[model samples]
Each structure stands twice: as structure tokens, then as C-alpha cells.
Target: MKAGSWSRLAAACLWLATAGCSARRSEPISKAELLTDKPSERGRVVFMEHCNRCHPGGEAGLGPALNHKPLPNFVKRYMVRRGIGSMPAFPQQLINDSDLKDLMSYLTALKRHERGADQTALEEINSRR
Candidate 1:
């Protein structure tokens, strides 16, 4: 091949490699890192089994990030049941009402922890001023 063609191919390969590296995702939460309460623990299991693939650690993967969304629990529940856009609907057979409730609890706890971390960082920055 011509030198120009070889250089262009090398640049494309380099770009693809870097792009993949940037897309590397965070690790999934472990059992040891359970947020709080028994419900959250149970919900964590449910989330790992069902939701983790698309929403790893509640962060965006194949789907949008759940951690930062300010949606209500009921809305989230409805979306899980009915689905929207690329997300598939999860029926009662897959996740019963009780498990769903537990999942919500886990999600709430995760959001709370995330918010607390953000607030703490902001407070620290302000204090340093």
C-alpha cells in the first residue's frame, strides 16, 4: 500500500483503541459494599442479576445512568414494567412486586449515597475557599 494509505490506517486503528479505552466502565458494586439495610442488600442482588448489564453500578452503559436521574420511584417502577425506547419491559414473572419494592429501596439508597458524596465534595471545596 502507499505510505499515505498506511498512515491513515494506523491513525484509524489508534483512534479506535483509544476510544475503547475511554469507554471502560466502572466495576459493579460488591456485596461487601452494600449501602444499608436488608432491603437494599436484597435489592442489590436483584439489580446485579437483572439491571447490572445495562446499568453497571447504576451508571450508564447500554442505557442511561440511573444514579443521576431525579426520577421518582413510581416512575422508575412504571418504566421497568412498561419500558420505554430501547429498554425492555420487565414483567411480574421476572421480578415480583416484593422484589421490585426491594429494588426501589436499593436504588434510593444508591442515589442518597451518591448525593451525599457530591454534597461532601462541594462542602470541602467551599471550606477550602
Candidate 2:
């Protein structure tokens, strides 16, 4: 082929190759899908669906003891939406907003109960001492 024809062919091939490169990459998961309301029961459901496979309920399993850590609301929410360390990112579709909220609330409540139990034990110890 002539030089001009070669150049045109090369340009067309390059354009086709670039177009076929697959630009439809996965989108970043949104935080809004994660539930962030108070008393997050739905959030707990979300947790069970995505997290329970790895982490145990109110106990440590594939993951660490989530209840053991007395994390604040924002931290919990962030972790749930963004995931942490070994945890996988669960997008809004996987865990809707209400579910995230419920999950956080349930975890916090579990933590609270644990603290109360610890306090009661300490009181007993003090009384005996």
C-alpha cells in the first residue's frame, strides 16, 4: 500500500484497538447505599448477608470480634461502607442504606450490653473485695 494509505490504515487500527480496550470498568461503590440511621436493624441484616460469611455474630470468626471494638458511629459507618483491612467492599446495591444503619445500631447495642455485663462483674468483684 502507498505511504498515505498505510498511515490511514494504521490510524484506523489504532482507533479500533483503543475502542476495544474496555473502558467499562467497575464504578466506585457509593456510601449512600449503606444504612446510617439510628438503631440499624436493617443494617444488621445487611451485615449478616455480607459479613456473616466471614465474621461470626457477636463473636469473632473469619474476621475479628467486631463487638469487642467499641467503635463510634462514623467509624462503624465508614468501615461498613468502605470496608477495612481484610473486609470486602459492599456497594450500595449489596447493602442498602437502611441495612447499614441497622447493622451499626445492632453492633453498638451488642457492645453496650457487653459493657454493662463487664460493669456488673466489676461491681461484684469490688463487693467481694
Candidate 3:
């Protein structure tokens, strides 16, 4: 085949491969409804589907604990969308406006729970002494 033909063929193949890959994961993630007006349940689905893989239970997994530091919301938001350190950036498409709102709720709730759990565990351990 001519050089031009080869390049065209390669481009076509690459496009097909990318399209196929995206199609496999294209099924929209059904977001869970917020149980209340509170932001607490807002980001649960997005968090579970994406963030949980790295930040299991919003605690340290492959990624560090999101709440342990309690940094500013903008900072966290920027870091998550833009990525920081080892954590990967989560584009708006994967986490739309609604998903991001709910995710903030999930993260906030997770932080409070983690704090409580930590205190409880410490108390229990001390009691054993």
C-alpha cells in the first residue's frame, strides 16, 4: 500500500479501537437519588463507583484518606478535578455536576464517620489497658 494509504488505515484502526473501548464503558452510571435535601447523600454513587476504588470507604487504600486532612473544599475540588500527587484527575464527564455534588456529600459524611470511628476505636483500646 502507498504511504498515505498506510497512514489512513492506521488512523482508521486507531479510531475503531478507541470507539470500541469507550463503547464498552459507555453505559451511564445510574446515580442514586439523594435521600434528603442534605448534601450528605449527594455524592455517594460517584464516590462508590470511582473514588472508592482508590480511597476505599473514603479512607486510605491506594489513595490517601480524603478527610483526615480536612482541607478547604476548593482545594479538594481542584485537586480531584485536576489531580494531585498520586491521585488521578476525575473529569466532569465521568463525574457530572450532579455526581460531583453527591460526591461532596459522600466525602463529608465519610469524614465524620471516620473521625467518630477513630475516637471509638481509641477509647475501646484504652479501656482494654
Candidate 4:
């Protein structure tokens, strides 16, 4: 093969590799999807603005996965109010009581949805057998 042809092929391979990596990244939630319940929707917005960076879609990223965490609401609330480990504390000013309640609602809903999905998949597999 020509030298130029080999260089072009290398460049194409590099581009394809980068493109694949970028495609694997999760996309941001859309506003329409957030319009489920008033409080939950608001909570979703708050999460995107504040918590999404570390906990993308409640899955672990920079921090632990919150969706699967078995912590109680009060414990979660306390953690938010008074930081834990690498997690930063979010005072009342950053997230008020009302917003916190909404956030909890969203988190609960997220956990339920994830569990439902897992259950559904399991049921499907069992049915196949």
C-alpha cells in the first residue's frame, strides 16, 4: 500500500476510536422527560444542576451510586446537609428544605424505576426458560 494510503487509514482509525468513545457518554436528560410530576420534575432539574456532575443518572461517577444505596431518607438528607467523605455539604442556602424534599422524591422514583427494569428483565429471562 502507498505511504499516503497508510497514513489516511491510521487517521480514519483514530477518528473512529474517538467517535466511539464520545458516543458511549450518556446524554443529558431532556426537559420534556423532566415534566413528569411537579415536585419530581423540579427535583430532576435540581439534580441536573447540582448532583449530575458526580452522580450521572444516579449511577456512580465521581461519587457512589445513589440509586441503589439503601440509605434512609433522613440519612441521605443529613449527608446532603452535612457532607460525607468526598461528597460536599449542601447547606440550606444551596438547597432549601422544599428542594431537598423534591430531590428525595426524584431519587426514590429513580430507584424504583431501576428496580422495575431489573425485575422486568429477570422475568423475561425466566419466561424464556
Q: Pick the candidate with the highest lDDT.
A: 1
Root-mean-square deviation (CA) per prediction: 13.2, 19.8, 15.8, 15.8
lDDT of 3 by residue, 11-59 (tens): 4454355431111111121122223335555576677788879876555
TM-score of 1: 0.66
Q: Which ten residues in a row have the lowest lDDT in candidate 4?
A: 22-31
What's the TM-score of every candidate structure? 0.66, 0.54, 0.63, 0.65
User: Any runs in candidate 1 off by more than 4 Å, and if so which?
Assistant: 1-34, 119-129
lDDT of 1 by residue, 7-93 (tens): 446544543554421221223222124357999889989999999999888777897677755567877887788776677889999
- Taking the tens digit of each residue's C-alpha lDDT, what string does model 2 give over 1-129? 875455446444543554322211111211112323456665566666787677655455676555555346766676666665567767788777777777777776555444344455556679998
Question: Where does model 2 exceed 4 Å of error?
Answer: 1-41, 115-129
CA deviation > 4 Å runs, candidate 4:
1-35, 119-129
- Which candidate's TM-score is highest? 1
State how far residue 119 of model 1 sits from its true place (Å): 6.2
| Candidate 3 error regions (>4 Å) | 1-38
RMSD of 4: 15.8
Candidate 3: C-alpha lDDT: 0.56
Query: Looking at model 1, how many pairs of residues clash?
Result: 0
Question: TM-score of predicted model 3?
Answer: 0.63
lDDT per residue as tens, model 4, 23-80: 1112232112222478888898888988999988877679766765555677678778
